[model samples]
Target: MLSLRGVRKSYGGTPALRPVDLDLVAGELVVLTGPSGSGKSTLLMIAGGWETPDGGEIVPRPPLPEVPVDRMSWRDLGFVPQSISLFEELTLADNLALARGGPGGAELLEALELGHLAARRPGEVSRGEQQRAAVARALVAAPSLVIADEPTSHQDHRRARLVLDLLRAAAVRGAAVLIASHDAAVVSRADREIRLDAPAVAPG
Candidate 1:
Protein backbone atom coordinates (compact mmCIF):
# COMPACT_ATOMS: atom_id res chain seq x y z
CA MET A 1 0.00 0.00 0.00
CA LEU A 2 2.20 2.84 -1.28
CA SER A 3 2.29 5.51 -3.92
CA LEU A 4 5.19 7.16 -5.75
CA ARG A 5 4.97 10.39 -7.69
CA GLY A 6 7.33 12.13 -10.08
CA VAL A 7 10.23 9.91 -9.06
CA ARG A 8 13.47 10.53 -10.88
CA LYS A 9 17.04 9.15 -10.74
CA SER A 10 20.36 9.42 -12.58
CA TYR A 11 23.94 8.22 -12.34
CA GLY A 12 26.96 10.35 -13.26
CA GLY A 13 24.63 12.89 -14.95
CA THR A 14 23.00 10.23 -17.12
CA PRO A 15 19.38 9.59 -16.32
CA ALA A 16 18.56 6.10 -15.09
CA LEU A 17 14.89 6.79 -14.51
CA ARG A 18 12.48 9.29 -15.90
CA PRO A 19 9.95 10.93 -13.62
CA VAL A 20 7.63 8.03 -12.77
CA ASP A 21 4.44 7.58 -10.85
CA LEU A 22 2.93 4.36 -9.49
CA ASP A 23 0.44 2.98 -7.02
CA LEU A 24 1.05 -0.28 -5.14
CA VAL A 25 -2.00 -1.76 -3.52
CA ALA A 26 -2.49 -4.67 -1.17
CA GLY A 27 -3.34 -8.15 -2.54
CA GLU A 28 -2.01 -7.45 -6.01
CA LEU A 29 0.75 -9.16 -7.98
CA VAL A 30 2.26 -6.57 -10.33
CA VAL A 31 5.08 -7.22 -12.75
CA LEU A 32 7.44 -4.70 -14.28
CA THR A 33 8.52 -5.79 -17.76
CA GLY A 34 10.82 -3.94 -20.12
CA PRO A 35 13.96 -3.87 -22.24
CA SER A 36 17.44 -4.27 -20.74
CA GLY A 37 18.09 -0.59 -19.87
CA SER A 38 14.50 0.28 -19.15
CA GLY A 39 15.06 1.26 -15.51
CA LYS A 40 12.70 -1.32 -14.01
CA SER A 41 15.27 -2.31 -11.44
CA THR A 42 16.10 1.32 -10.77
CA LEU A 43 12.46 2.10 -10.17
CA LEU A 44 12.12 -0.90 -7.85
CA MET A 45 15.18 0.26 -5.90
CA ILE A 46 13.80 3.76 -5.57
CA ALA A 47 10.28 2.58 -4.75
CA GLY A 48 11.62 0.27 -2.05
CA GLY A 49 13.93 3.00 -0.77
CA TRP A 50 17.00 0.85 -1.48
CA GLU A 51 18.16 3.82 -3.57
CA THR A 52 17.29 7.46 -3.31
CA PRO A 53 15.55 9.36 -6.06
CA ASP A 54 16.79 12.64 -7.42
CA GLY A 55 13.33 14.14 -7.26
CA GLY A 56 9.96 12.63 -6.32
CA GLU A 57 7.89 11.51 -3.36
CA ILE A 58 7.09 8.15 -1.75
CA VAL A 59 4.17 8.08 0.62
CA PRO A 60 3.92 4.70 2.33
CA ARG A 61 0.73 4.08 4.21
CA PRO A 62 1.32 0.64 5.68
CA PRO A 63 -1.90 -0.80 7.05
CA LEU A 64 -0.82 -1.74 10.58
CA PRO A 65 2.02 0.67 11.19
CA GLU A 66 3.46 3.90 9.85
CA VAL A 67 6.84 2.50 8.92
CA PRO A 68 8.46 4.54 6.17
CA VAL A 69 8.60 2.60 2.91
CA ASP A 70 12.31 3.11 2.38
CA ARG A 71 13.18 2.41 6.00
CA MET A 72 11.13 -0.72 6.61
CA SER A 73 12.71 -3.55 8.55
CA TRP A 74 12.75 -7.12 7.23
CA ARG A 75 9.80 -7.81 9.48
CA ASP A 76 7.60 -5.28 7.73
CA LEU A 77 8.96 -5.77 4.23
CA GLY A 78 10.03 -8.86 2.30
CA PHE A 79 12.52 -8.44 -0.54
CA VAL A 80 13.97 -10.95 -3.03
CA PRO A 81 16.78 -9.05 -4.68
CA GLN A 82 18.53 -9.87 -7.98
CA SER A 83 21.68 -10.92 -6.21
CA ILE A 84 21.42 -13.89 -3.88
CA SER A 85 22.68 -12.70 -0.49
CA LEU A 86 22.30 -15.85 1.57
CA PHE A 87 24.99 -16.39 4.18
CA GLU A 88 27.44 -18.88 2.81
CA GLU A 89 28.82 -19.67 6.24
CA LEU A 90 25.53 -20.77 7.71
CA THR A 91 23.41 -23.78 6.91
CA LEU A 92 20.22 -22.96 5.14
CA ALA A 93 18.25 -23.53 8.33
CA ASP A 94 20.54 -21.32 10.34
CA ASN A 95 20.40 -18.67 7.70
CA LEU A 96 16.67 -18.68 8.16
CA ALA A 97 17.10 -18.33 11.88
CA LEU A 98 19.22 -15.28 11.25
CA ALA A 99 16.27 -13.60 9.56
CA ARG A 100 15.65 -11.65 12.78
CA GLY A 101 12.16 -12.54 13.98
CA GLY A 102 10.90 -14.10 10.78
CA PRO A 103 8.72 -17.16 11.19
CA GLY A 104 7.78 -20.16 9.01
CA GLY A 105 11.14 -20.74 7.38
CA ALA A 106 10.80 -24.51 7.43
CA GLU A 107 7.37 -24.50 5.89
CA LEU A 108 8.54 -22.17 3.17
CA LEU A 109 11.44 -24.41 2.36
CA GLU A 110 9.16 -27.43 2.08
CA ALA A 111 6.79 -25.52 -0.14
CA LEU A 112 9.63 -24.72 -2.49
CA GLU A 113 10.80 -28.34 -2.34
CA LEU A 114 13.97 -27.18 -0.64
CA GLY A 115 13.39 -29.07 2.61
CA HIS A 116 15.92 -31.80 1.84
CA LEU A 117 18.67 -29.26 1.42
CA ALA A 118 17.99 -27.39 4.62
CA ALA A 119 21.19 -28.51 6.25
CA ARG A 120 23.42 -27.45 3.40
CA ARG A 121 25.27 -24.18 3.03
CA PRO A 122 24.75 -21.73 0.20
CA GLY A 123 27.83 -22.95 -1.64
CA GLU A 124 26.75 -26.54 -1.13
CA VAL A 125 23.50 -26.20 -3.00
CA SER A 126 22.68 -25.43 -6.61
CA ARG A 127 22.19 -21.79 -7.51
CA GLY A 128 18.52 -22.36 -8.18
CA GLU A 129 18.06 -23.95 -4.79
CA GLN A 130 19.89 -21.06 -3.22
CA GLN A 131 17.61 -18.63 -5.00
CA ARG A 132 14.53 -20.46 -3.74
CA ALA A 133 15.96 -20.38 -0.26
CA ALA A 134 16.42 -16.66 -0.60
CA VAL A 135 12.77 -16.39 -1.57
CA ALA A 136 11.80 -18.47 1.44
CA ARG A 137 13.77 -16.21 3.72
CA ALA A 138 12.04 -13.15 2.31
CA LEU A 139 8.59 -14.63 2.90
CA VAL A 140 9.28 -16.10 6.34
CA ALA A 141 8.36 -12.82 7.98
CA ALA A 142 5.00 -12.37 6.26
CA PRO A 143 5.96 -8.85 5.27
CA SER A 144 3.36 -6.36 4.12
CA LEU A 145 5.23 -5.43 0.97
CA VAL A 146 7.25 -7.89 -1.13
CA ILE A 147 9.58 -6.57 -3.81
CA ALA A 148 11.49 -8.98 -6.02
CA ASP A 149 13.88 -8.43 -8.92
CA GLU A 150 13.85 -11.23 -11.46
CA PRO A 151 13.07 -13.77 -8.78
CA THR A 152 12.50 -16.64 -11.15
CA SER A 153 15.52 -16.13 -13.37
CA HIS A 154 17.29 -19.16 -11.99
CA GLN A 155 14.59 -21.81 -12.26
CA ASP A 156 13.05 -24.14 -14.81
CA HIS A 157 9.35 -24.30 -15.57
CA ARG A 158 8.29 -26.33 -12.54
CA ARG A 159 10.48 -24.58 -9.99
CA ALA A 160 9.56 -21.22 -11.41
CA ARG A 161 5.93 -22.15 -11.03
CA LEU A 162 6.55 -23.06 -7.41
CA VAL A 163 8.16 -19.69 -6.83
CA LEU A 164 5.35 -17.87 -8.59
CA ASP A 165 2.72 -19.74 -6.64
CA LEU A 166 4.45 -18.84 -3.41
CA LEU A 167 4.61 -15.19 -4.35
CA ARG A 168 0.99 -15.19 -5.47
CA ALA A 169 0.03 -16.81 -2.20
CA ALA A 170 1.68 -13.90 -0.43
CA ALA A 171 -0.44 -11.50 -2.39
CA VAL A 172 -3.56 -13.48 -1.58
CA ARG A 173 -2.71 -13.13 2.07
CA GLY A 174 -2.64 -9.34 1.64
CA ALA A 175 0.83 -8.23 0.65
CA ALA A 176 1.75 -5.96 -2.21
CA VAL A 177 4.15 -7.96 -4.39
CA LEU A 178 6.00 -6.06 -7.12
CA ILE A 179 8.38 -7.92 -9.38
CA ALA A 180 10.65 -6.77 -12.23
CA SER A 181 11.25 -9.28 -14.98
CA HIS A 182 11.70 -9.87 -18.71
CA ASP A 183 10.16 -13.35 -18.77
CA ALA A 184 6.98 -13.64 -20.76
CA ALA A 185 5.74 -16.49 -18.58
CA VAL A 186 6.19 -14.36 -15.51
CA VAL A 187 4.39 -11.47 -17.17
CA SER A 188 1.45 -13.66 -18.20
CA ARG A 189 0.78 -14.67 -14.60
CA ALA A 190 0.79 -11.17 -13.19
CA ASP A 191 -2.45 -9.43 -12.23
CA ARG A 192 -1.09 -6.33 -13.95
CA GLU A 193 1.96 -5.37 -15.94
CA ILE A 194 3.97 -2.13 -16.05
CA ARG A 195 6.10 -2.12 -19.17
CA LEU A 196 9.13 0.15 -19.32
CA ASP A 197 11.52 1.41 -22.00
CA ALA A 198 15.10 2.63 -22.19
CA PRO A 199 15.65 5.88 -20.35
CA ALA A 200 17.05 8.81 -22.28
CA VAL A 201 20.74 9.57 -21.94
CA ALA A 202 21.71 12.91 -20.50
CA PRO A 203 23.42 15.55 -22.66
CA GLY A 204 27.16 15.94 -22.22
Candidate 2:
Protein backbone atom coordinates (compact mmCIF):
# COMPACT_ATOMS: atom_id res chain seq x y z
CA MET A 1 0.00 0.00 0.00
CA LEU A 2 1.03 3.63 -0.56
CA SER A 3 1.23 5.46 2.73
CA LEU A 4 2.19 8.98 3.81
CA ARG A 5 3.24 9.71 7.38
CA GLY A 6 3.20 13.25 8.71
CA VAL A 7 3.68 14.74 5.26
CA ARG A 8 4.32 18.46 5.02
CA LYS A 9 5.24 20.93 2.26
CA SER A 10 5.37 24.63 1.52
CA TYR A 11 6.06 27.20 -1.18
CA GLY A 12 8.75 29.64 -0.12
CA GLY A 13 7.77 30.52 3.45
CA THR A 14 4.11 29.89 2.85
CA PRO A 15 2.68 26.48 3.65
CA ALA A 16 0.82 24.42 1.07
CA LEU A 17 0.33 20.96 2.59
CA ARG A 18 -0.18 20.00 6.19
CA PRO A 19 0.94 16.91 8.05
CA VAL A 20 -1.39 14.80 5.96
CA ASP A 21 -1.63 11.04 6.17
CA LEU A 22 -3.16 8.75 3.57
CA ASP A 23 -3.05 5.17 2.45
CA LEU A 24 -3.81 3.63 -0.95
CA VAL A 25 -3.87 -0.02 -1.77
CA ALA A 26 -3.57 -1.71 -5.11
CA GLY A 27 -6.83 -2.30 -6.99
CA GLU A 28 -8.22 0.80 -5.38
CA LEU A 29 -8.88 4.37 -6.53
CA VAL A 30 -8.46 7.29 -4.13
CA VAL A 31 -9.73 10.79 -4.75
CA LEU A 32 -8.23 13.92 -3.16
CA THR A 33 -10.79 16.67 -2.95
CA GLY A 34 -10.65 20.15 -1.43
CA PRO A 35 -10.93 23.85 -2.17
CA SER A 36 -8.30 25.73 -4.15
CA GLY A 37 -4.99 26.14 -2.25
CA SER A 38 -6.14 23.50 0.19
CA GLY A 39 -2.93 21.61 -0.72
CA LYS A 40 -4.66 18.89 -2.70
CA SER A 41 -2.28 19.43 -5.60
CA THR A 42 0.72 19.62 -3.33
CA LEU A 43 -0.21 16.35 -1.67
CA LEU A 44 -0.65 14.60 -5.02
CA MET A 45 2.61 16.00 -6.35
CA ILE A 46 4.45 14.76 -3.30
CA ALA A 47 2.86 11.36 -3.57
CA GLY A 48 3.79 11.10 -7.23
CA GLY A 49 7.39 12.15 -6.57
CA TRP A 50 6.97 15.29 -8.65
CA GLU A 51 7.54 17.34 -5.53
CA THR A 52 9.21 16.80 -2.18
CA PRO A 53 7.70 17.38 1.21
CA ASP A 54 9.52 19.46 3.78
CA GLY A 55 9.04 16.67 6.29
CA GLY A 56 7.48 13.19 6.31
CA GLU A 57 7.81 9.68 5.05
CA ILE A 58 6.33 8.36 1.80
CA VAL A 59 5.97 4.70 1.14
CA PRO A 60 5.11 3.44 -2.30
CA ARG A 61 2.70 0.57 -2.80
CA PRO A 62 5.58 -1.93 -3.01
CA PRO A 63 9.28 -2.27 -3.60
CA LEU A 64 9.72 1.12 -2.01
CA PRO A 65 9.14 2.85 1.30
CA GLU A 66 10.59 5.74 3.28
CA VAL A 67 12.63 6.68 0.22
CA PRO A 68 13.61 10.16 -0.79
CA VAL A 69 11.36 11.56 -3.50
CA ASP A 70 14.30 12.50 -5.74
CA ARG A 71 15.82 9.05 -5.42
CA MET A 72 12.65 7.28 -6.50
CA SER A 73 12.24 6.22 -10.10
CA TRP A 74 8.62 7.21 -10.45
CA ARG A 75 8.44 6.13 -14.09
CA ASP A 76 6.37 3.16 -12.95
CA LEU A 77 3.93 5.79 -11.77
CA GLY A 78 1.68 7.10 -14.55
CA PHE A 79 0.92 10.78 -14.24
CA VAL A 80 -1.56 13.13 -15.91
CA PRO A 81 -0.75 16.52 -14.50
CA GLN A 82 -3.25 19.39 -14.34
CA SER A 83 -1.80 20.68 -17.59
CA ILE A 84 -1.99 18.56 -20.74
CA SER A 85 1.63 17.63 -21.50
CA LEU A 86 1.39 16.64 -25.15
CA PHE A 87 3.66 17.58 -28.01
CA GLU A 88 1.81 19.97 -30.26
CA GLU A 89 4.22 19.36 -33.14
CA LEU A 90 4.34 15.58 -33.01
CA THR A 91 1.62 13.20 -34.16
CA LEU A 92 -0.26 11.45 -31.39
CA ALA A 93 1.48 8.17 -32.19
CA ASP A 94 4.95 9.63 -31.90
CA ASN A 95 4.18 11.30 -28.62
CA LEU A 96 2.85 8.05 -27.23
CA ALA A 97 5.84 6.04 -28.39
CA LEU A 98 8.16 8.58 -26.86
CA ALA A 99 6.36 8.61 -23.54
CA ARG A 100 5.32 4.97 -23.31
CA GLY A 101 8.42 3.46 -25.00
CA GLY A 102 6.29 1.06 -27.08
CA PRO A 103 3.50 0.63 -29.67
CA GLY A 104 0.38 0.51 -27.49
CA GLY A 105 -0.52 4.07 -28.47
CA ALA A 106 -2.91 3.12 -31.23
CA GLU A 107 -4.63 0.54 -29.08
CA LEU A 108 -5.06 2.98 -26.23
CA LEU A 109 -6.33 5.63 -28.59
CA GLU A 110 -8.88 3.20 -30.00
CA ALA A 111 -10.06 2.37 -26.51
CA LEU A 112 -10.45 6.06 -25.70
CA GLU A 113 -12.30 6.64 -28.99
CA LEU A 114 -9.46 8.74 -30.39
CA GLY A 115 -8.12 6.27 -32.91
CA HIS A 116 -9.07 8.54 -35.76
CA LEU A 117 -6.90 11.26 -34.31
CA ALA A 118 -3.76 9.18 -34.04
CA ALA A 119 -2.29 10.67 -37.19
CA ARG A 120 -3.10 14.17 -36.07
CA ARG A 121 -1.09 16.46 -33.87
CA PRO A 122 -2.21 17.45 -30.41
CA GLY A 123 -3.00 20.92 -31.77
CA GLU A 124 -5.30 19.38 -34.34
CA VAL A 125 -7.55 17.77 -31.75
CA SER A 126 -10.21 19.32 -29.57
CA ARG A 127 -9.40 20.13 -25.95
CA GLY A 128 -11.22 17.05 -24.74
CA GLU A 129 -9.57 14.82 -27.29
CA GLN A 130 -6.17 16.11 -26.24
CA GLN A 131 -7.07 15.38 -22.65
CA ARG A 132 -7.94 11.81 -23.58
CA ALA A 133 -4.70 11.43 -25.47
CA ALA A 134 -2.78 12.62 -22.43
CA VAL A 135 -4.50 9.94 -20.41
CA ALA A 136 -3.85 7.26 -23.01
CA ARG A 137 -0.16 8.07 -22.97
CA ALA A 138 -0.09 7.58 -19.22
CA LEU A 139 -1.82 4.19 -19.55
CA VAL A 140 0.42 2.89 -22.33
CA ALA A 141 3.06 1.79 -19.84
CA ALA A 142 0.45 0.17 -17.55
CA PRO A 143 1.83 1.85 -14.45
CA SER A 144 1.37 0.37 -11.00
CA LEU A 145 0.07 3.70 -9.74
CA VAL A 146 -1.84 6.32 -11.72
CA ILE A 147 -1.92 9.91 -10.49
CA ALA A 148 -4.08 12.48 -12.25
CA ASP A 149 -4.62 16.11 -11.30
CA GLU A 150 -7.89 17.70 -12.41
CA PRO A 151 -8.20 15.14 -15.19
CA THR A 152 -11.81 15.98 -15.98
CA SER A 153 -11.51 19.73 -15.79
CA HIS A 154 -12.12 20.40 -19.47
CA GLN A 155 -14.07 17.30 -20.35
CA ASP A 156 -17.79 17.03 -20.89
CA HIS A 157 -19.85 14.42 -19.11
CA ARG A 158 -19.24 11.76 -21.72
CA ARG A 159 -15.53 12.35 -21.86
CA ALA A 160 -15.27 12.65 -18.11
CA ARG A 161 -16.91 9.27 -17.73
CA LEU A 162 -14.46 7.84 -20.22
CA VAL A 163 -11.54 9.19 -18.19
CA LEU A 164 -12.94 7.78 -14.98
CA ASP A 165 -13.57 4.46 -16.66
CA LEU A 166 -9.99 4.34 -17.83
CA LEU A 167 -8.73 4.93 -14.30
CA ARG A 168 -11.07 2.27 -12.94
CA ALA A 169 -9.74 -0.20 -15.48
CA ALA A 170 -6.20 0.58 -14.36
CA ALA A 171 -7.16 -0.08 -10.75
CA VAL A 172 -8.83 -3.34 -11.76
CA ARG A 173 -5.47 -4.37 -13.14
CA GLY A 174 -4.01 -3.83 -9.64
CA ALA A 175 -2.74 -0.29 -10.17
CA ALA A 176 -3.21 2.08 -7.27
CA VAL A 177 -5.03 5.12 -8.68
CA LEU A 178 -5.06 8.55 -7.04
CA ILE A 179 -6.79 11.58 -8.53
CA ALA A 180 -6.70 15.13 -7.21
CA SER A 181 -9.72 17.03 -8.46
CA HIS A 182 -12.46 19.39 -7.40
CA ASP A 183 -15.18 17.84 -9.55
CA ALA A 184 -17.76 16.02 -7.51
CA ALA A 185 -18.50 13.64 -10.34
CA VAL A 186 -14.94 12.37 -10.39
CA VAL A 187 -14.61 12.15 -6.59
CA SER A 188 -17.91 10.29 -6.28
CA ARG A 189 -16.64 7.49 -8.52
CA ALA A 190 -13.44 6.86 -6.58
CA ASP A 191 -13.22 3.86 -4.21
CA ARG A 192 -11.89 6.17 -1.48
CA GLU A 193 -11.68 9.91 -0.86
CA ILE A 194 -9.00 12.03 0.93
CA ARG A 195 -9.60 15.64 1.76
CA LEU A 196 -6.43 17.73 2.22
CA ASP A 197 -6.81 20.83 4.25
CA ALA A 198 -4.37 23.75 4.40
CA PRO A 199 -0.81 23.01 5.43
CA ALA A 200 0.09 23.06 9.11
CA VAL A 201 3.48 24.44 10.02
CA ALA A 202 5.67 22.40 12.28
CA PRO A 203 6.47 23.70 15.71
CA GLY A 204 10.08 24.53 16.41
Among the numbered candidates, top lDDT falls to 1
Where in model 1 is the C-alpha error above 4 Å?
61-73, 100-103
Model 2 lDDT per residue over 70-126, tens place: 222345777787667777778888778866765666878987889988999988888
Error of 1 at 66 (Å): 16
Tens-place lDDT per residue, model 1, 1-204, is: 789998888999888888888899999999998788779999887767677789988896233323433222346777777787887888888777766453348888999999999999989999999889888887887888888889999999999999999999999999999999988888988999988767567876
Error of 1 at 93 (Å): 1.5
How far off is residue 194 in model 1, in Å? 0.5
In model 2, what lDDT does residue 192 have? 90
Looking at candidate 1, the ten consecutive residues that score lowest on lDDT are 63-72
All-Cα superposition RMSD per candidate: 3.5, 4.0
Clashing pairs in 2: 17-199, 18-199
Q: Any idea what lDDT model 2 has?
A: 0.80
lDDT of 1 at 3: 95
Off by over 4 Å in 2: 60-74, 198-204
TM-score of each: 0.91, 0.88
